[model samples]
Target: MDDQLAFRADDQPSSTSPPVWRVLAVDDDVDFQRATAFALSELDLLGGRIELLQAFSCREAALLLARERDIALVLLDVVMETEDAGLRLIKALREVIGNSETRVVLLTGEPGRAPAHEVMRDYDINDYWTKSELSAERLLTVLTAAVRGYAQLKTVASARRGLQMIVESSNALFCSKNTRELSSKILSEIAVLLNLQAEGIVCVRAEEGEGGVAKARIISASGRFRPSVDASLDSLDSPEVAAVLRRSLQGQQTLCLSDCTVLFFPRFQAGADYACYVATERVLDDTELELLKVFSASISRGLYNVALFSRLEEMAYQDDLLKIPNRNALIRMLDMTLKDESKAERVLVLIDIDNFSGANTAFGTGYGDFILGLVAKRLCDAFDGNVLIARVRDDLFAILGPQTQVRAADIVALFRRQTRPYELGQVHSLSSVTMNLGDFTGSAGVALQDALLTLKQAKRAGHDQHAVYDSRLLGAHAEAYRMLLALRDAVEAGHISVQLQPQIDLQTRRVTGVEALARWRKADGSMVPPLSFIPLAEATGYILPLGDLLMRLALQAAKELADAGYGDIRVAVNVSAPQLLQHDFIERFVAHLQAAGVRPQQVEVEITESVAMRTFDTVCEKLRALREMGVNVAIDDFGTGFSSLSYLRLLPADRLKIDRSFVLEIGQVSNEQMIAEAVIQIAARVGMQVIAEGVETRQQADWILEHGCREAQGYLFAKAMGCSDLLRWLADWPRDRA
Candidate 1:
């Protein structure tokens, strides 16, 4: 072994001495070995860094090689102690020292002794060089190529291992559901995969207060830096740090510090924004960056999922239009309030807008929406600290407050005063807001439907008012609603009966015709006035059926009167606005008259000027159709509609009835008399008969008669009486002198 080491030293001579390859010479020929070591020493392999090791046999080379692991290349003679001894060393080096990564070059003096091809194929050595071709440059070239190849392979393998770790780490980090947990895992995984010195994740919440404030909470951390935990980025005091963090949060871009790199990923859910930060200082290559990008996308998606789930949960209990708690949320809150012993006293106030439909028509849907939102805002602002407000419908709002602080009057007043005139663009709009208050009076339990009913009564009584709920109010409202239902049933069952007020021709002192009026007599024999129930019927859409019933009754009555020796008298029946505008109303009326076997001229249809003015074209068409059917159409209550004078000429009317208001003030107001006279003159000029209504006294009747009015109807002649009463009165009246 000592001789091998000494010969290896001679193989690589010093530059000032001689060049050598420093190959391990394991030859048994002592003379040949001395000459070969000296010759190889002059051939500088590895820049003369190599040194020869002469064994003079296989056993010596084995002993020397076992002690040295840094030998670059080995050259052995084929005729050593054992021809395969060099092969055994390769195996030993691989198994024992684990030096498989190292390069080994073999040399042989006898080209045929080991057979260069056979040794190259069988051994793990890198190359085969015969003694004759083993020049200094050739050996140097072979050794250099082997060393460079090993270095390249080591680099590739190390890079491959790093990429695999990154991929595994990304997968682990992205699999987490909780954002904080996911962020923590990301930092820890990155730290382990990249071998980072320090790592952390900073999650920023941007929607804390009004207009939003940025607050970052550190989810995970390692090394000496304290985790941000409860500390907000806005409270960081360092302007530069806050600025950078804010920019990262806003732009959603990665930032690099002196020792830390941060990547910002904007997490969006249902169109709202949040941010996630992954930071580390370790150097990352393309593979790590790509892996991090994919991890960021996964984190963003997870955050989006969480946000979406939260939003869906919120929507489950939120009103879509007002963004307030809906009925479900209100019930839940009420349940919670009731369950708590500390929250004993609770008050609920239901607010409703007065004449909301009128307001809707006057302003428009857009303005109506603005008014509703304004009311909601007022309710929210006025009792924000003491009450919770929610919109239940387009015009209904609910307020929940402490019983001690809330009163029925207080809430009613609050709602009434909240409807201040609002400006829409340049237009000024006003809404008459009202509300009904219901308290837990202990007599009647509070119910949502009952409260709504009380509000309905308050609106029906007249608008811009409120009705407090009491047992009496509830009873009355229930009775009114029951009456309405009974009235509807009566009309539906053909139980409605008609009475007629005679129109007396004062000059002749005889009844010319009678106006048909609806009368509702209860089972107790008490009468329900036309004024009392007609408006309700109109509002409830029962007027359409009621009008049809009245028309049929009036036609039958006229036909009966004609058959009973009262042929000249006609029956006039009033038509509501809704009835007049009903589709195919004229055809229906004509069909009814024909079915009753009454001549069209014997029955007159009276439509108020207001209804006629509202749908002038439609009313004209209907009147024209009626005229064509030989039915006389009259414009009732003229001079009260505020209509254009030209409309009176254009209407296809057989007669015009002067409204009672003008007749009442005919002698009181000079302008009223002039207006009434002008209306009569216009009707005359248009070839229409003018009938003065409500001629109650001699003076009024005389004035109307002297004015050349063709007809007059009022209480003086006869009040509206049932059929039997009218026939009895007709039997007592004097004969006509027409």
Candidate 2:
């Protein structure tokens, strides 16, 4: 039979009375049941009187157990209805009724029906005895211990359930993106753990500033407390609840009052202290109080992690020294603004400090940096905190604001203001034009490039320059970028050809050597001047392969001319500084001549004097290796560069090719003639040959020879031509038509 509430008293106690323990007795003998009831009926077991329940058969006992909530003990008879009928009831009680918490004892009139030791050991029985052995005192003692064990197990299960709730709630709270979300979750989870109503308020305050919790406010609430959401501590309607929160905010420890609980989460850096208040009618047990403390620690750790994430964001996007936005932050702001069509007439302006290097030299770097910080501060004040200013470079600042406030005229006026006496430097400023809100399409990178392009034009004009961006401004920079891409492709394809310019011995008027010049003609047969692309090639580092191609083709032409009886010839090709700095330049040079089947003696390497003057020891080592291999080295553009006398005397060179600027004015400018003569005399004293470039007239040639220089190359001899054409020109040399 399923159990009824045969008796119950004080199920939950407050020390006013002892806990009631229920016990059931199962037997088929009617007299034994009455006798057992008479013996245990008035017994005070486990500090409370027993409420003896009766069951006549195994099925009846199983029913009794299924009906009861906390049946503490079961008394059984061995031979009832069948030999194993009582044993079968135990199985039904444990499996069907699911009463594992109740203790069972076997009391039988016939001991031989079930073995005493076996029944006690094999079955889940607390004791096995004949009817003669179970006295009133022994029964009371056995019942008291079972009831105590049951109460202990129940308490353990309750604690395990609370711990499980804590683990699950922590997972949800840790994923909360902000404090507001975390506040709501904390209140709901604590209510669930305590088996109370989902009603509480989460309040937080910055650490005990100005005393008490006047600044504290409720961030989240639910149930009856929902109306108090966002209410400050001073505005709380319930004075008792407000006092509890104030105590928690000021104190470092959690408080479990007689009618409520306030959890105090301590302050972590970048975060405020949080106090969560929940109402209850009675004080919690030790287990509940301990669980809340553990829950508080776990939630506090999550808050600390959120604070750390926010701090890392500041470090990433804030300038370390200027205390302003950095380039990354500026770009992020630009992207956000451009993505929103509702934004107003805003423009990006770049301000650069002209001659900034001179400032670093005039003042020490320490003072220069201090001046830059001052500039950042002044710009912020001048804009009246209305614009977003960024330190994009050491000496360059960018501003994003309404175009009316950030106009070029205002920036120029600010720079020229007489009261500004710090003397930072002449400042150049430019603002990008306002693009069409409905039609403009580009990324933040594109917008930044436009601002930078305008700044470049302003800076190039002079100091204290100002301009507004236009479509036509700085078109050359964009065009140069496009041309660099094409040049890289052309050099890879080896499309540039070499032209030979004859260098004639002045007195003999005979061809001695030829200078190889690189020439580029596009598919349309339009020539790109060397002035346009040569510097572009050097600046973009395409000169490495361009240098290699020129050398390979120059050597091939030299081989062809040698085959045509133009023997003992040297063809000179220019090498840039970046190419000369390569560790493998000398190795590659030897490999190129060997691959072309041309002798090293037929090649001449021309490095500008400016390139040779830097890193004297390194350049001398490479040049000496070249001369050792029977290759000739000449300093190209001789007088136009560093003109270091030690460079000339130190370089192991074969000739100094006088720059064309000095040679072109040789007859017209007396100073040019003197410089050319001085170069010729210096070449003689240094034991090197002298070749005057750009000999356009017989008078210029005569000036060179009269100054004791034998070599000259210009239009006076022949313009540069193909090797086949040069061979034809060579056969017609010294043939005059005038």
Q: Give every collision pair in model 2.
A: 1-60, 1-63, 1-64, 2-63, 2-64, 3-64
State the displacement of the C-alpha of residue 427, model 1, in Å, after optimal TM-score superposition: 8.9
Compared with the true structure, what per-residue lDDT tens digits does model 2 show for residues 503-607? 988777778899999998776788888888888767545566677788888889999988988877688878888788876788888888888888888888998
The per-model lDDT (C-alpha) reads 0.63, 0.73
Question: What global local distance difference test value does model 1 have?
Answer: 0.63
Per residue, candidate 1 scores C-alpha lDDT tens digits across 364-427 of 6567677677776766667756576766555677776687765556655554433553534221
- Candidate 2 Cα RMSD (Å): 32.2
Best by TM-score: 2
Backbone-clash count (model 2):
6
State TM-scores per candidate: 0.53, 0.58
TM-score of 1: 0.53
